[model samples]
Target: MADKSTNNIELKVLVDKESNKVIFIEPENDFVDVLFSFMTIPMGTIIRLARKHSDPVVIGCMNNLYASVENIDEQKFWIDICKDMLLHPCNAADHHCNLLKLKLDDAEPRRYFMCWYTSSCKFLSYDRNTSSPCHGGVMDREKSLRLDPSQVGNVFVKGEIRFTVTDDLQVIPPIASTNYVFTKLDVMDVDATEELTINIGTVEMLNLLMTSLVSKTPLTETLLKPKQEPKLSSSKIINQAIHIESQMFGDPMDGDEEGKISVKLVVSKSKKMVCYAEAGEDFVSLLFSFLTLPLGFILKNMKDGSLRGCISHLYKTIRDLDGQYMISNHHNEMILDPKLVPGFCYKNSLLGIEETSYYLVNNMLTTDRSLISTEPSQLKVIGKKDDSALGFLKGPAMFVVTDNLVVRPISRILELHILKDLNVPVTDIEDQIVHVGKKEALHLLLSSFLCDSVLTNTFVADLREPKQEQ
Candidate 1:
């Protein structure tokens, strides 16, 4: 009866204290069945069980039996085995814990060990010289733990541990989504009225217009100078009044359909000055377009009465001819003949004339010449003398010469007519002639041409008589 009872026990594994190796196990034992049952047990539970019993525990599977120890001397070996088992659970068919064949001359003491199966059993003893395969599949739980001293207060407990979950052992909260709203409001009650009165001379207006045309900067920025008292006489000053009014008819909160905006602008001249004014947004935009015109073109147009009547008054008021004169002689010492009087002359000097001396052959002028002698040599001598005399006579002849003139090529008669009509001083014309000679002729031509065109297009009767409404 005792033998039968002993036979029911599957295996007996004996460990040598000195060698720390599994020394013996029954051949026909049921140790493999006992080890296979441990395959389903959690590694943590197995570790706790091993820690409770000081003695070595014999486990077996698939005709293999091995002993586990919690020896202080082999603590690292047991810990490594436990970590491997936790990372890779052993299968019933392939067990990682196995008893190694004992050798007589082995220098190091052998230690019984067990680990999660990889391809074959890998003992955890230091002398086994075998690498653990669970490293590839092992979860780095230490890295996920918030165990740093700095993270002690920051660590948060998210939720209660759940054991019924099949897919996820650890749960992480998802980041929250956000939505934003933007709003814009419009003014509904507007009752604004503004009136501005500006009194500027034509010269100041011209300066401002010129600055706007020539500079890329805005007009407001260029006109940011300190206010100065009017230097021009009241007669030359132009009074401009600007009145602007804006009103809102309905509340904006009611919707865009209910809200209505009304704007009004009035630009007029005062009773003192006859100023030309334009109002409304379209006229203002058109005025702004004038700034894009070329500076030379703007100056040229200013001379014309088409832009503003004040410009003409300004021109007459500033016109002065203190010192001016016309050239009488050319550098080549050629003089105008007394018999041919020039139509236009300033200070007793012809308007346009150039002097030059050149010899001319008689054949070019006439086919035949009557020489005093009939002899070939004598006739040749006479012809040469005649040619020399003709050249000398032609040298100083005034035939309405136009090239290389001291005065500009513009019609002197026309300028005289305009100046007389404008009531400009004769001396002012002379000064203008001098100024033209000093500066570029093209600059003078631009002003003169624009003025002539404007004057020609303008009605003479209208200029002479005031309008019935005015």
Candidate 2:
């Protein structure tokens, strides 16, 4: 591995422009345990769901301190290795992990746990040994740095939580309460920046292993939510933030190899008077909800709540207000700037006579976000009735093809595929096929939207429902 600084353009340090690449990684890079390997357990539990909170998996990690050096030699060695090398399995870093250092409060059997281990995203910094950081970190040998974001870690499902913290490392903002890291206490409660004393390669390996062990258990919406009350006050939110990070759990395995990864619980700095609003909601409501709080006192409190990104239900009154809601690429600590996004509902007639633009933000389907181009002519995609005819399939909404024409269940992916297949961009919104002849345009739109259905002669039957004769 060579230094990235070797890339010299002009006299400037082209750190920003030149991409960083890693030259090599050793030790076979395998993060997952080989078959029959006595790896720490984090398997078999299903951890389905997102934006969830639950009790921590508790393991008597204090027993770890008891079984040191003399008792479990390899375990002790790894623990020492972790503390010294950092991210070494079970070594110097045992106390910091949420899984192993928690205190058990419940009387449940020591069978499984909910605590799953995940690491921060791939961290890159100047390393004297490497020119690029593109090295993969998984292999059967060495097992030093486990940095792959997608790797799964050992699973500890269904255990009660027991926590232990050290007095060392000089915790910035200081530890608050017995098991809480409040927003008021630290800005890094949700995000942190600091220098770590460990080889970058080694840290990557550990991250890979830790993330692999994060439980992939099946969790439902029922399990993802807490039975307790919702909407905590600023003080309570802060008080509850620190202890949210839990460590260690018991791994119970089923036959399946891949399971669910649980979303980690986190807290961030907010204002004294925190406001919650949905996408496409009124901006004045949001502003009044938040701004009405004394700005002097709000900034003075410094941190209390987190401004949630993409509340989904937020609706701003104007385009300007909507622009402030879309800033997902966060850039600051004091204030969170939301991405500019406007919501739309075809049924509400948000579109005008022509050339109205809107964002169709789906709660599902995250990948391949692209801009869609369609003509003024519309296509109607009808949802079929179930076999029993008990109810109609609640299909996707309508799309406008002409000023007065509209069609339901217009697939966005279909348009993209058509463009790709036809080898040309859609150049116009108004169709020459309208009035002159709607047949060709309708054929193109329908064929593109309804994948795999062959149309014979492109003729649609007139099946409009007519008024009953008196």
Candidate 3:
């Protein structure tokens, strides 16, 4: 017989440790349903609940009822038994028993334990002992019966919230918290629908409401709002001064502003003639192009046009035209003074001159002994001039012209040897005269001099048309 002082709920349940199933829950009640819900609760939460409610209580299951010991070791053993019965088993139906008893103090309400199970089942446990019954615990039986349809967990429903503007064009922003419940509707089975409810604030509500309202307004009305043009400071506005040069040839269609010249042009008018002049970009470009031409080619073209005379003739004319001319060539003829010439000149000395002449003759004989067919007798040194007014000319210079018309300077000693080879007498041989059979006289005519000048002035001009390699 149960103690009359204790309140008890008699439940017939089948428990199988192998299957972890509690079946045939007899006379099921709210407390029993809550307890069943905790069958799958985590072990850690159960351990925490056991620690919180350390008071000894009688728990009955599987035809067995035992007082839960408050001692740590006994409590651990009971917890392991509950865990094995609830979780580790394969099926509770296999180990079913008809009689189970849960006894409680009659002074305490049944809802106390029910609330404990309910709170322990949550992700965060609620303290049933410390909290008021109606405050944090499960709803009472009457309230649970009158539960709202929205409160039901396993129901399917859809709803929308709308904000409408009334007669007043002015709309007061919604201040109340709004909620949106997104649900997957099940047309075939309304009871199996899933829903997720989200609490929204005024901003989110206005954002959703404005989306539809904006679509009704004309787009042009929003676009027509006056936009302020950016104002640039005086410093930011760049003052660009663009100068354009006028062309020599004019395009009649172009405006005067486009053709205006930037460079200054000063044209003087004579008493008998008037000249029109324009010195612009085109004139400067033409001048630069002419300047890029080869100097020899330019001089040749000028001579051909009679704009410039022969260079030698010009030199002679300048010397004759200016009586005080200090410049003269080797032949005592006046020439244009060199703007810059070599600073050192060959020193004139009889011994020095004889040594240099001997060195030159020996070098020539050693290089080409065929210049003199026969050896010459030793010669005496003749009178030499140490005073020569010519700038680059050293006295006793002899010119030798080969058969190929190549003229070169030879020493007087070599000239004497050549004259002796020709069987000419030493007395008849002039120091400056170099007559040889293997050479021709290079005529010093004005036209020849002009040609020579042109050839000398002309730079390397291969001008051979490039032939592609086969």
Ranking by lDDT: 3, 1, 2
lDDT of 2 at 321: 28
Q: Which parts of model 1 are misplaced by more than 4 Å?
A: 1-280, 304-470
Which segments of model 2 are wrong by more than 4 Å? 1-52, 55-376, 384-470
State the weakest 10-residue window (summed lDDT) of model 3.
58-67
lDDT of 1 by residue, 115-173 (tens): 33422322122223233344433211111111212212111111221111000001111
The residue-by-residue lDDT of candidate 3 on 1-470, one tens digit each, is: 22243333333322222432321122223212122112212222222232222231111010010111111122222223322222221111101101112211111111111233332221111122333233465422110111122312211111221211111111111232322111111123323332222222222222212121112211111112112211111111111110111122122323333322122211111211101112222222211111112112222222221111122122223234332211112111101221100111112210110110111122121111223356622211111111232212222333332111122343456545544554545444221111111001011111111221111111111211111211
Q: Model 3: clashing residue pairs?
A: 18-89, 18-90, 19-89, 19-90, 19-91, 21-92
Give Cα-based local distance difference scores for all models: 0.20, 0.18, 0.20
lDDT, candidate 3, equals 0.20
TM-score on alpha carbons, each prediction: 0.12, 0.14, 0.12
lDDT of 1 at 172: 13
TM-score of 3: 0.12
Residue 128 lDDT, candidate 3, scale 0-100: 28
Best by TM-score: 2
User: Where does model 3 exceed 4 Å of error?
Assistant: 1-7, 13-25, 39-44, 51-470
Q: Candidate order by TM-score, highest to lowest?
A: 2, 1, 3
